[model samples]
Target: MYGDVDVPAAVQRALTGFLDLQQERLEAIGPELTEQVQAARDATSGGKRLRPAFCYWGFRAAGGDPAQPILTAAASLEMLHVSALVHDDVMDSSDTRRGAPAAHRRFEALQRARSEVSGVGGDPVGFGVGAAILLGDLCLIWADEMLHTSGFDAAALARASKFFDAVRVEVTAGQYLDLVAQASGVSDMDQALRVLRYKSATYTVERPLHIGAALAGGDRRLIEALSAYGLPVGEAFQLRDDLLGVFGDPALTGKPAGDDLREGKRTVLVAYAVDHASEVQLAEFDRLFGRPDLDDDEIQLLREILQDSRAVRACEDLITERTEDALDALDRAPLADDTARKALADLAIAATSRQL
Candidate 1:
């Protein structure tokens, strides 16, 4: 699926170089800025480079040659992704990320320690939240900066910038929609799906492809085909994630066990379960699901209900259906060669598969 390009390795090198340069600039500000830069470095570490892979392949499929500028620009997508994750962790009040303390949690812990020593900072959690918000904003700005400084000519950058801008808006709107759905405590499939498409579908896959394609000066035909392939794949990707969030090993997922259940994520699976639930099951589900203090037995019981409701099966079907749709579209896309098509097909499978 990777073709000749080791996308993850290449992006890692690019990110390392970029962060090093960023650190130099931060040094001019103050030595105390060391932690901030380290925080950024840590956040960018251990990513699957999925977004960057999509961006790289999109450029490749559009007939773009391997170039240094593209690598830096692709790495910027990771910055954007990291930005989203930091803010998302804050929003979800997640304790861990990538199997370590979440950005906000890290900051909170730092503040708590400092407050204990000096007795200065009040409300350590709030301090952590504020710091994480700044960190997310910093990454967001870095994403734009990295792209603009990627050494691409103005024309190509201009072309790609449109999609980059659009993706930012789409992901933010999607996140807001998700927040609304969770707060409303309504498990409507249509609403959940809307949240899915906007939150994950467009930003994660479709726009990354579009940005890369545009950078390569690909025509509207190529852009449409990429979306035709990318959107369904993106939806399937999130659907798989929904299942994992509920049922997968927390250690593997780098999240608290049943965190999604505790948070009451209004995913399509949840919607399906709710729609098909019996009266007594609904009552129990409402009582136990989303309770922050739900015990192990309650968690197991929720899992059983999800399984018995057949929502898991429905979600699995949707993943298969969307993956097939993506592969079909990729087979028909006007890619530069068969290699790109095969790589894309491979990515589709990886995105929708159960593996983390």
Candidate 2:
């Protein structure tokens, strides 16, 4: 459902191989560590593999071959993404992910089960949180290791590493900004967009493209062009995600509806609603928008306010505008491979389409 590049299978194979090897290594150190590795595997499994799709097609666009090294390097993005998701779930105190118990939640359940069987007293919640943090850190470390061992030429790996490192720093900073915005309860679109760009745009698309291009020894011109196309599409992807958080079906999204509202996301959709809401609507918004105990009826009420204020429609327009801009940039990207260009074109639509 992504780039139509037939690479998801290959990416999955590569990821499985790496995880298997890492699990063996972990077992050698201590069998008790198996659960952490299993958690990593669980976090890495499923999802769209969008980051790897972006990286693989980016490499192909820059004339990289469908070789092992490129595929392995592309698969490394999944590791980094897993690290983010595990930590993000912990930070959000989310109970579920990908339609299953979140990492911390899973750990918490395990702790509870052990306590019940052993009749022992312990801090199950704290243990779960601590274990999840270490698991997240392990994923981060392994992601770097995977990239370095991906079999690319040393020179190429070095070049790609720069972008890879930048993505980590930028995403961390973006997460910090998001936390700040939520804490301050700011409703400014500018702050929301800033957080969006740093938290998601670069990591999801721009730097992945850059890393892929660097691995292929692509020149500065190609890297810049890919960035031009990636950034806006990335923004559109996140905007659509914000919409889905409130309006999407749980069956499709693997999340409860209005979870973002309960978390006080401070997304652009909320900002628009705040700006456009009438007195009565604003009063209702203030009452139900961010309450942890927000009920289904209140969610429906907020949805009505968002719709009546045209925030949802305005966000849809922005998504469409950004998608068009991304396609236009793709057309002018100077890619020599027609197939690569077409794949990226398909990806732009997939990235921001309603079905996502």
Candidate 3:
């Protein structure tokens, strides 16, 4: 979508350089660890690179130099994102990511192959999950290493680290909250929105921009402007994602249709459905929404209920409102670079309007 964008390319190059150096370091440690390093490489592959773009543009809009250090720092966000995704796939028991085998699934396949050759029986599932967890941990560690060693001045790095650290803490907390929300099966829209704010909104948009602004030595005013813009935009982004998880084409979304329904996510859409559904619709919904074995007919029924309740339309309306708010915030902010402002506007559209 952003074929003309130079910043995503710069971010990708920085990521590649860092991962290549990491692979070399692992090779020096021992050839036995080669496959794990390769798994790390695979897990980091093929994303929209949105977090890095947010960071890059935030810095640029603040009159920060488009230099290697800032680019490297921006790319570090991708590493952190990868870490979250790897662990997320594991936690969600997802089989695929980026239209390929997830990290844990790949490790499972490797373990199975080894066992077949050795004629031994073992818990491939346990081994795979363990390896994937360690790989995710390594990605987080490398993210910190990349930012600290990006050649930014110590003061800038220190300042940026606060946002970065908070991102880690908040996202982790949000993940735990999500697990609890799922287990408890809460249906309140406000409660669901709180999960969205921490699990996705902050880490996805707010903190990346905050980290960039801090690195640029931006004032409190600029940071506040960015928060105003980022929070709503990020919420819209995740709202779009929730819609896609249920209704998106697998070819476009890189996941099965109705995946979110199967997972029993207590999203705002589900909450709205519960509030507006008829008794019969609610009964059917309770039976089908979380069924791991949901068939196409069952999935279609749930989709119909969501539509009948106008939950889908409500979610769409919220997305539009949030997006407009983000643009309004952007317009009011005293951004130094017109190009950066335009880029951010384009990003807001792309983030909310994407099919994938």
Candidate 4:
């Protein structure tokens, strides 16, 4: 009851219980699936549970009472999130997630070791990618199953299904947009911001809140209010993530320093730097911006180019602006629970200012 609505541990317990049951089902299939099940577990375990927290608080703000049913429903979002992370890492070819090998990489390693021991020949990369995609698909399936079976009555499930469906579609669309942006090799601010809005903003915060509000029978006005508050906050949160990807410490961020720099992500931060860079700075930027083999010094040089261009400052400004917009909308929202409103306000600050 974290002060009124959200309970992180309860969310974790709900997810753990579900995963345990699924693990049993997987193990019964064959011993070869043992590693796969563990990988799935690792993908889902440990996070701030921010989406669940937001959804739970959204329910409270809509005048719903604290109940166990909401926890299971909210925890299902974590499964969906795991699906996103697994697929995103595969797409990015990211080696690590939360300081561990990303799911595809883990799968690749497992298959590689098995093939060597068995003297069986297979494409390790293909095996890893295929397995990771299956893992993501399983998680996606479980997310819907967990939500529908969450002890909510039929009406509540029906009410929330629209938003739930929307989240899935919006996030996938956002991922596609992001992929296209990368392929186009353009760093226009508008394109970057558009991708951020869909990829992170809507699905990460706004839709989950909508799902919760719908479950609680919140009116259309409240849903509108949540959208006003959630979308900007979500954008700010991802903006902070963009900064962390470039400038954060590996220890705190749970990835290599400048992970995005190595990936050559055409984030708004990169766009800003490109826009403001001097000819000499642009020369250096062009030379070292996207090389996957960026050494420590090269990353530092890239950092210098961004900082010198005031791109970091530009991103900081955007985060501050969007967060303020979210808070203002929250203040004006007609929430029944003062406590939930306060919790969300604090969350906005912590989320944008977070080091991880």
Candidate 5:
């Protein structure tokens, strides 16, 4: 089986080639739309492309070739993800992403520069956020278009499209639940896991695998098996991401340290920390958890508390357990090809083991 960071060279080359083709297609859409499309497409530059890789391998596992149309459709899903992130950052008002200025922030700077040149602008940040939203919407439309034109059979197209649509709804619902949970200070670990499963796992991993399998005309058994593997891996992936948000090196992650704390994300890790902390630690956490004025020293102290309380260790143990379950699922899955199965296993490790 492939290990973490051991993506096959062929897969890497195919993905790169697919991205180039998609970028060209995005740029050729129209002059008026080209700039926005390009901006949206460029926003994908820094991501790990895990979803598209999953789709590609899932296709292979279901007995499909990694050729033009299949790979193109797979790449389109990446664009869809990128579009979601662009809009999400705007909505979250995140200043940085992928260790640099977020798309909205970049666009805000552009708007300010244009305003200075043309003598027009009330609030550049607002204008930029609006523009980024529109651009994200455009990318979503084009993602569907690309999928439609991807040369799959009608049945395959319908199946994949249906899954993709369902993913959108599930993810949106998850996001809604996440916001509600955070606002209400509902720290139930079970509720937090549900939010993670629906919002992060189903869409990020399970549905994408199912979509790929559907495109290749896989049976229901195979689809269910893929989901079985995907759910745990996907949840683990997001859980690792939450850890990174607080403890990850800012240079690697392309964001300020303790961003999740600043945003007050009600992740499972945070909930566990709260549950396990002492009265003194709880007092400190309550004072600083959602405070925007937290300094580096305070964040460091919070990290220490999380470690001393063993929440970090507990979270890591959960990640390992989930990953092992995913691996076991993959092992028992009736994959027709060994290479594809190995690739999928490798992907799970990479998704969960990243530091950034």
Candidate 6:
């Protein structure tokens, strides 16, 4: 079941410790700025810490010492992820995150309270969004600063920087594709795969692994092998997330059921269902997709339609296929240690098997 890979207890400690270090750095910047940064930092506290863990394990897999520098660099990635989330929540107008008030919402509350006390009308939404945007930018800048100042050798720093740059570029491209597809709809499997590669796979898994490996002085061949394993696994992970967004229990996922349906995410599952659906089903989809006002019963019916159309089965099959591809790549990779390999394998399983 769980704990299939004996992840080093020290590694886990290092991850948290690095996070604390970054928090301290953020707080020290200024007392006036501390509240915003602290809010941003608190937003990240409850995640699975998957990215940092991946970075740590990837470094260890390449025989790098889990020293201060490595731990700091790994934590930096977590900060970057937080930055992305702050911006994403604003973009999505999400009210909650990790089962709590989203950053912008929290700021909105603060603004309203201040306005009521002062008897003035301040644009809460605008102020909240502006603050969130700045906070996200600060996080990105700090992530780079932390990575650069981690005392790695110049060569290692350069390599890691290049890898981070690639990650940023790929993730931006992926996000653009996601937005485009949401607007235009994905017509075929090829376009859907492109979305998967750019939006989720490269940033979520491949680049994180590569950055860790690069920091540890891994050879190009090793990095390439890790990327191969990461791509399909990451895609599978996102696909599972897509399913959960539509079908998962709200208590488990910290989101309302059918949030994805409301959001109109052009996921592979939706695309497959639309392609295979009958005319009536297609009409129902067109009516419900992206409609925020749909009631619970309507959402339930949409789920039923998805099940009836066998899109659920098709998505599950794709998960299986992608998981197998990831494992196959791992089998052929020239990993140096059994622990690292086992951890990667367990991660692949855990990522797709998650209920929330």
Cα RMSD to the true fold for all candidates: 1.1, 1.2, 1.4, 1.4, 3.1, 2.7
lDDT of 2 by residue, 1-356 (tens): 45455667877888889989999999999998999988888888788878888888888888888754787898889999988888998998888888889899999898999999999958889989989999989989988998999998899999999999999999899999989988997689999999889999898989998998888888989999999999999999999999999998888888888999899889999999999999999988987877888989889989999999999999999999998998999989978577888888888878788554
lDDT of each: 0.90, 0.88, 0.89, 0.90, 0.79, 0.79
Pairs with steric clashes in candidate 6: none
* Superposed model 3: Cα runs more than 4 Å off: 1-5
- Predicted candidate 5, C-alpha RMSD: 3.1
lDDT of 1 by residue, 179-257 (tens): 9999998899999999999899998899999988888889999999999999999999999999998888877888877
Instruction: Return whichever of 4 and 6 wins on TM-score.
Output: 4
Can you tell me which runs of candidate 2 are displaced by over 4 Å? 1-4, 354-356
Backbone clash numbers for all candidates listed? 0, 0, 0, 0, 1, 0
> Model 1 misses residue 104 by how many Å?
0.5
Output the better candidate (5/6) by TM-score.
6
Q: What is the TM-score of each predicted model, taking all chains together?
A: 0.98, 0.98, 0.97, 0.97, 0.90, 0.91
Tell me the lDDT of candidate 6: 0.79
The candidate with the higher TM-score, 3 or 5, is 3
Better of 1 and 3 by TM-score: 1
Q: Per-residue lDDT tens digits of candidate 4, residues 1-356?
A: 35554467888788889988888988899878777668877877777788888898899889887754998999999999999999999999999999899999988998899899999969999999999999999999999999999999899999999999999999999999889888887688998998899999998889989998889999999999999999999999999999999989898888999889888899999999999999999988988877899999999999999999999999999999999999999999999899889988988887789898
Compare candidates 2 and 5 on lDDT and give the better one: 2
* lDDT measured at residue 148 in model 4 versus the true structure, 0 to 100: 97
> Candidate 5 — which residues are off by over 4 angstroms?
1-35
Q: Determine which window of 10 residues in candidate 5 has minimal summed lDDT.
A: 1-10
Candidate 6 per-residue lDDT, tens place, 1-356, comes to 21332233433454456556666776687666666756765765767666766776778778887544676677677777878888877877788878888888888888888999999977999988888888888777767876787678889989888889988788778777777887785436667778888777887888888989998889989999998899898899888988998999888888888988888778888888888889999898888888878799989988988898898999999899999999999999887767788888988998888997
Instruction: Give the worst 10-residue stretch by lDDT in candidate 1.
Output: 1-10
Residues 151-249, model 5: lDDT tens digits: 788888998888888887887788788878778765678878888998899878998888888898888899999988999999999989989999998
Q: Estimate, for each residue in 194-218, the C-alpha lDDT of model 3 and write its tens digit.
A: 8899999999999999999899988
